[model samples]
Target: MRSSVDKAAVKMSRRWKLICVPTVIVTVIICFTSTYLLLVKGTNRWGSGRGLRVNQNTRRTGVETTRNFSRIGNREEKTRENITKVVDREQNKILMTNSAAVAVCCTDLMNLDKDKAVIIGRRRKNKGFLTIGIPNTPRSFGKSDLKRTLKSLIQNTPNDLGQSHVSIVVFASALDQSTRLSTRDIVAGFPEHVQSGLLQLIEAPRSFYPNLSALTGSDLYNRVKQNVDNAFLLAYAMDSADFYLQLSDNVRAPSNYLQSIRDFIKQQGGAYWVTLEFYPVGFTGKLFHGGGRDMQQLIHLFTEYAREQSVESLFGHFKDLNVQLRDAVRRPPLFAS
Candidate 1:
């Protein structure tokens, strides 16, 4: 009886131990799984929070940077357009100003003319006239030489012409340093017949450029000629003068120059190829044949030549440097039309 009772107690104790061991193992496993799951969820939440903030910052920065660049580009484009418009406006204003100036000058010239002068075909002459008008230019020719030239012209002119038919007008200046004396003194100094032949002593402006070539190009010359022509028309009541002449202040005339020109003009009709024959100092011997015809025909010839040629070709031929004269020469005579 005691052995059976002991066996039953041992069995009961074994069963109780087995059941408690399994239950403990199950509780341990549940605790470990719950802890692991909680750790994983915390890690995931932390990573998500960091990534979201970083994405928001990146987007915000990109948008702000794009806005700044776009604003800068627009400003630069507006500045360029404004600069272009200003330049165009400036150019237009300059052009308009120049045009107005030209118109005013033209109007003044037209009103001043008495009437439109007529251009007649050249009349034939047995001998052409060389009328020298020496307007007083400052330091144009030396004092002694100028007087000598004038004296020579007076002396030689009488000897050449059978009668005093040579026309001369000494355009003097009261202000000229060289000619302190009146035009009367200068005229009185000439031979009686030559003095008698003196057409007129027109007092001119002191600062007139005495160079014939320079006068040919100047507006002053044109203005003077127009006034002179008007005066001539008023004096003689005629449209045009029959002849034109050129004179040098410093050059002395040869005794036979007039006679030679007369004979040449007689033979050649309206146009004669006349040139100035130079003599060396103190010698009075032949130097060379230089000078040209009247300004009108020369201008005519140049105009005709230009019609068949270009500016380059014509300038290349003469090699002269007078740009205004070249342009005027290359065109038809203003007086001719």
Candidate 2:
């Protein structure tokens, strides 16, 4: 009985050892795998410079942190250099084009008087001339606005009138160098028009408004300056065309706008000016007949009116003058005296 019990006990002990040994092997494998995974994750997270971390105490004096910062700075500098190179290449390409060459050769109009506007592009032979004036203030106007305006004018005008019959004179005044460059670039986009002499780009002379500050208070001064600019544009347009269309940069033309103007002129028998009324917005100085003396007198009168303290009073005075002038013209002239 004792022998049998000893054998059974030994067998039981062997079974227990087998179970314990396997459990120990599995636990060891799990621990080793977990440690290896943690090491890999740590390496991945900190390996790239993108997520590099430096301890607060070490960051101040560590050579590694210093090197990393230098590397980043160099990378940024290289990016800037690349951008500058691209810009230079683009400008050089523009300079090489025939259109750009002509633009560069054309005289700068800033110093030139209204009569001396240098005409670029082709001149068309038509029944009458039409000059469109566009004044650009960099603060309010931009390349996209000019492009849209020009495109509308070109595409919507009557084909019979032809692009040659119409002249576009852009008055670029008080713009910075970069804005002027951008304007030139915008002008360059219309290669056909620029080459055809239908488009003329002119700059206002630097000394045009030398005493702008002395003119009036800031608000009044801006108003007067705008009036003067419009007056100058009108005078310039009169020099080239019998009919002048003064347009704001932001306005879009209807497809039949040119045809409508022609019809209106015929209906009025060549009226001094054709005031356009925008729907819901009221009257605008969009269209005007460049009638010889009458238009000039009106422009001068308007300029004076713009300087008054009260705009309501100015218009009131104008209404009175207009009524008197109309009556005088309508009444029969006395034979002598």
Candidate 3:
């Protein structure tokens, strides 16, 4: 009777082990699987820098116009009121206070109506050595050919090369609701570029313009607004890279334009050249050196002398004063207006 009881006890213990081990294993697997799914779903819907309105812009005035290069940087201690986040993760997006800062970069979704020249996009920092600055205002709104232009530019520029050195900055600086919405629509189409930091949108900052309302239609007032706009564009890009290519909203480039421009700029090796022209259509296809001092000087010239001479003519003036002779044209033309 004792031997039979011992055998039964051993069988019962073995059965319990077999059932309990499988149940524990299944429970652990289910917990991990559920947690992973939820996390992934959350990220897809709300990730860091879902990308700012790649399509929107910042604006300014005088019957007026717009602003910056998202090719990107920053500063502190200048005593700013804290610009609303350029890359605000504030899912709450609770319209924050408006103040001025040297620069602001945004990587997440947020309201953009109140801020001007706020840097909002994936590529907040200046990447690579080239920044393409396109000034699109209310008249055109950067809608015409902007997509095509971006496609070609991006196609010509690869990821590593672009992420490292190339960024396209569209100045859609219209502060109005219409312009803002329009810009958002356009940029939303290129979420990929925004994420990659190859493209960005910017507007002018608060008080970016210095009381030009009184001088409307004066030569000092007329083109100064636009020239100043360009100056702002270049200013935003000054720290972005070694070279800046200024283009109009409606322009086209050849397949080899990027390579050709690279080669041309390289050939200048240590040469003193202020403006390299592609098509001679005002500032449509002009490339300027991205040196801070050089660009600031040129920007100064644009804002001050632009009141006297037109920007196109001013280009010639800058070249004449700055260099004995710089290459003004590239053969077969690399770009067209």
In order of listing, the candidates' clash counts read: 3, 6, 19
Q: What are the RMSD figures for all models against the true structure?
A: 32.7, 26.4, 23.6
Q: Considering TM-score, where higher is better, how would the candidates rank from best to worst?
A: 3, 2, 1
lDDT of each candidate versus the true structure = 0.36, 0.51, 0.61
lDDT of 2 by residue, 1-337 (tens): 9999999999999999999999999999977765555554432232343223432222221011111122222322344335334334433332334554334222222123654444334333442567777776554333337778777777776655655467777766543677776777776788877776567776655454436667756677766666556555555566467777666555566776666666655664422222332222211224445555334534543344445523333323332322221211201211101
Residues 1-337 of candidate 1: C-alpha lDDT, one tens digit per residue:
9999999999999999999999999999977765554564432242344221112111221011111122222322344345334333533332234455434432332233322221111211223234444443334334434455566666667644423334455544334444645444655565554435433344433222223345554444543343332222222211122333334345666666555544533553332122222222211211111122122212222232323433223322222111111111211111110
For candidate 1, the lDDT comes to 0.36
* Candidate 3: segments with Cα more than 4 A from true spot: 1-116, 123-127, 140-144, 218-221
lDDT of 3 by residue, 1-337 (tens): 9999999999999999899999999999877765554464332233443332342242222111112222322322211123113222221121122211111212111122323454556544533678899876655333466766767777778777776778888887665768766766776677887887787888775466657777766556657677777777777777677888988766776777778888988876654456777766577787877754456555655655445667766665555333224355766667754
Candidate 3, which ten residues in sequence have the lowest lDDT sum?
A: 101-110
Give the per-residue Cα lDDT of candidate 3 at 276: 76
Better model by TM-score: candidate 2 vs candidate 3? 3
Residue 149 miss distance in model 2 (angstroms): 1.1
Local lDDT at 231 for model 3: 70
Candidate 1 regions off by >4 Å?
A: 1-130, 140-144, 158-164, 174-184, 205-241, 264-337
Error of 1 at 209 (Å): 11
